[model samples]
Target: MRDLSPPAPRARGALGVAAAVLMAAATLAAPAHAAAAPAGGTAEAAVTAPAPPMGFTNRDSTRCRAEFDEAYVKKIADILVAKGLKDAGYTYVNLDDCWARPARDDQGRLVPDPVRFPNGIKALADHVHAKGLKFGLLAGAGARTCDPAGFPGSLGHEAGDARQFADWGVDHLTYADCGGGGDAEQRYAAMSDALRATGRPVVLTVADQGANRSWEWDGDVAQVRRTTGAGTDGWGSVLARVKQNLPLAAHTGPGRWNDPDALHVGGYGMTETQYRTQFSLWSVMAAPLVIGSDLRKLDAVSAEILTNREVIAVDQDPRGKPGEVVASDAGRWVISKELADGSRAVALFNETNRPRHIATTAGAVGLPAASGYKARDLWTALEKGTSGTIAATVPAHGTVLLKVSADREWSQLPPLLDTTISGDAVARPGTTQRVASAVTNHGGAATGTVTLTLTGGDGWTAQPVTAASTDRLKAGATLGTEWDVTVPAGATGRHELTLTTKYRSRDGLTFTSAIPVPVLVGVTRPPAGESYLGDQAPLAATNGWGPVEKDLSNGESNAGDGSPITINGTVFAKGLGVNSPSSVEYYTAGRCTRVTAQVGLDDEAGTQGTVTFEIWADHQQVASIPKMTNADAARSLTADVSTAETVRLVVTDGGDGAAYDHADWADLKITCA
Candidate 1:
């Protein structure tokens, strides 16, 4: 990736001294590489030094194939160059497992599969090199590679394998851990030393499944370290990797990186929203943008997501520092990464199943005090003015990635004022909902008298609780206004309320803007009779793998791919199945009385899963099963919800990893009046 190439000049200009102020803030946050050692010490600083530069690769395409031949490998190389991917920064054609023979040659050297590579590995490498891209191969540290075919690995023959790969002109080597390897550090280091001794510049990528806290030691051992396995393209897998690797940002720097695995965008395992979230998060994490899908089948949407230069810039910033979480409330998160240009990449992520408003201030994200700020949405490329507040109503499992700069051209734009709302937007007919709007002046100059007016849809009424106008407000001042909005007794759907604000700039120019606030009316009632939980659509479902299944076991990470719900060889006709770290919630309308289900680890998980089930009514836990395993029989469970407005079904990993933790809620039933 020519990621090290100087980035194109950024747009400049914001009202007031916002640009200058933010530049000062960036000066403080973006420190030089020679800065004093952090809490970790000099060794840590040394490892943070820029490592060799690397481009993207087609690693996953080969992995998805059963057995790729020379024709296939060359085809991928052609696609990488011809599909605009190479121009977009992808520059490697990599081969995964099963590319080598199970046994070595008479000379004790690794050999390419005879039938698959009739022309040999050297020819393939040359073909790829001729396309102006590098070539990469995978090897195992143990006696055999991870593939079931048990290809010969580079365990005791590290030097010999290194020589063979070097002779083949291999540019990148992925050393994975499998086949009953000895100590991982010793094995990994042995290969590292061997590769160096071969007088070749091979980029070593350590794939140890994040064992032994690799971030703590792999910086010197390999150019890149796997922070986690390449999990399925499920939301659960993506979420898990992000949570595990997010705190290890301190270990990442130029040359060496903490990789959370391949890019799963444009895959079938998740929705478009979730895919965008993955791309945004990976870019901010500075993780390698390894394309994990077949290049031949690449879709337009995926290409767009992968080719967004703005997001990619955050990953390839000259500073090479990973983004870190600035603030978090429950499931809402605000992450900030400092760029080399004195700008900050802010990600307001909503990890919950419901839409949520996430907010943060420039000061909180390390921006200096400015009259106002300019925020550009990296995804939409839309530029907007903000009065210090950076916020958005993010969809479930979505992210709002913004490139925020201070005081770019403050004088050209009008005085900066931001408006926001606080309070519930849901109500029943004939009910009154109280909501407050706060307007803050973040301009460099004071504003003229500001007036705020509330108007509602037909049959709806809105009245201010007090005066809605304030005398000239100074810079950095806030005005709070409240209103009582009543829903018409006949209303049954969404009603819109417009909050309009009118004010004048210091130059006597007037400006007006209207913000729409939607109010949802009517209550969501539970089923009128006893019903199977699978029959009702959940208000929210956050699953560890794929989407929650109805009347089926959580088979794999794709929707509608699960088999019938089963536990201990017992089949149930009606229920829901999910993976660990899962939650399914339904509105009960405070009329539900009882909930019953037979729950256990599904037989589809073999004997490898262990999970615990919990039932929550409203916000309180009403029942729980401490532990259950795939080997155990299905157990009966129940929860009382006589006065509960909502019921949640949850499954958690049993104090261990969530791998294979497929759980079931067989024979689930709920009674409501």
Candidate 2:
């Protein structure tokens, strides 16, 4: 089967939390290995959205492609509606490539392939509607699809093709292309416009497919935004596709969905357990439950899995909030969703072959730990009695979906808001640095009221600026502003900032988001020389790091301020370097000339933690160690900073946990001429 979306390396972890201002600077700093900058800005986010399709879909590209015609489509529709899929929301039958002829008629309109659909597209659509089912068609956004058969695409003919689709009473149009026309955002928007002009409501779908990061910008232009590329049949393919959409959960909701391609249940290369896993995962993610398998060959196992009314209810919940991975370890994965009614939907996934025991407490998922709730297994449709923790024995590649309802009302759409600050991380003791703050709405509905208050950090003067928004922000939309932060003259140490966001949901529920932001400033600009041994350094700290003069944990400072860091098990912060390691530290030297610092990975070299130390001078890193395991010895590093005023020390986890990142600067000091 030909897949409409292109393939690429899998990318994960797109969302994160708030860090202190100064630490955020170190973590947000450009990495040594940086990718190309994003091409589209916030404007690309879909604003005006079309009405969403509230039903499940079945597409041909997964198995049959465009091989079958009128008889085959009607047969599948009959099976679905007859088997009770229609009432359960499986209502669309989509026709993919090879459905159209190579060329249009004399009027330059698309013509159905005379051989495949001799009865014409309108006739088939009519047949579909006669059964109370909707019709869906697939076309490319370019001159041609990857379809070698030369089926005329809807690229330059968006309006004409759209008009034809509307006239034929088509209900769904999946717009995918190989990128041969203008901007992707514009091309898709054009089709949306053309379809709307026809005066018929069509569910327009654009394949975001990782190429354009379409999930971020494919605002309401289309009903659903395809998040991943085409999915394969096997379990490896299924898990790969599923994990890739983890960080993207924030970008999807009610009106728009993050597609993980199709569902291969009881289909080619799939098993009963894989089927359950796929179905359960899709439901929690709020993904479209499109059946890519054969509806004609429904077995007891497949039918039982598909018609689970309880599972379907979770998917079609009115709140429209998607589920996300809360905790993962070894072969066990835990995902959670906050249902509209304040209930909780939790799934325990076993990825390995052998059966595994997985358990999670209600409190871990926002439910009161001590509060007892009724637990119902969506798979078995049986109550497991009321309990605080729900534990299950799951088969390999199998999933257990549980709907936990407590006595307390906990209904809310959730917090889909994330804020980011940009500008300068470095500020002079007496001057101000103007930075921008951006808040992205990744939930289902608009935010009620958003307010930003800046509580200034230590050793600073000027008043802290604040901002707020009362207007409701659209899903996938972003709002931002600039703030002027000043540092008082002769101030010292690290400046910590507390940025708070107080907002309400559409339901009039109040929510507050407070984040810590740290700012770095040198005590003196120039002509002031400072020196200290590695363990005796007074450096400002970021996200996880504490005051440089002493260990915040107190336990790790046992090596004494005069000696190197010796005791392990105290990793406070991990820098913004690779994999967002366990912790990160940033330091700046003022008016330093030639600085020689003796850095050691661990004072207790006998420990098992791994730590790497790096020195940064101005824009480029002067010296560094990449792989520092527990057994590696320490060394002295010297860098020339005569022409520079700021230098940073970055520490990272060495492909392991930060339990032993007992780094120490024995003889760390900077002197000016």
Estimated TM-score for each candidate: 0.75, 0.54
Residue range 1-673, candidate 1, lDDT tens digits: 1111222332322421243233223333332222212122333232222422334444555563654778888888887777677766666677888788789989988888878898899999888888888788899999999888788889999988987887888877889888867788778878876765665656688887676566665544676888875666678778777877898888776657788888777776788889999989988888877777776777888878877878877776767678899987757889998887888999989887655678899989888888678888899776656667787767678998998888667644466577767777568999888999888876566788899988887788888896688878777788999899888998975566778889887668787766667666774666777988668767678788878999999988689999989999999988998997788988787788999999999888898868899998876889999999888999999999888877899887674457788999999999988
lDDT tens digits, residue span 1-673, model 2: 1011221222222321111122223322222111111112122121212112433344533333654776777788788788787766676777766677788899989888777788999999888877877778888888876467656767888878987887887777888766488788778867876765655656678864555667655543565777665665566557656766766888766546677777777575677878888988888887777777777777768877777878877876656668888788754888988886888899999865444557777778776554355666787665433335566556657898999766332223443466655666566788887877776664445777777766685555334354446477676677786677778787655666666677777778776655555666664443455644233233333211222334222122222232324423333231111111221222444455766655555435455656566666654667776766645554667777666545656565553333334465435566665
Candidate 1: worst 10 consecutive residues by lDDT?
1-10
Which residues of candidate 1, in runs, are more than 4 Å off? 1-67, 369-372, 382-387, 405-524, 528-532, 557-575, 593-600, 607-647, 650-657, 666-673
lDDT of each: 0.76, 0.61
Instruction: Show model 2 residue runs off by greater than 4 Å.
Output: 1-67, 368-370, 408-673
Error of 2 at 54 (Å): 6.9
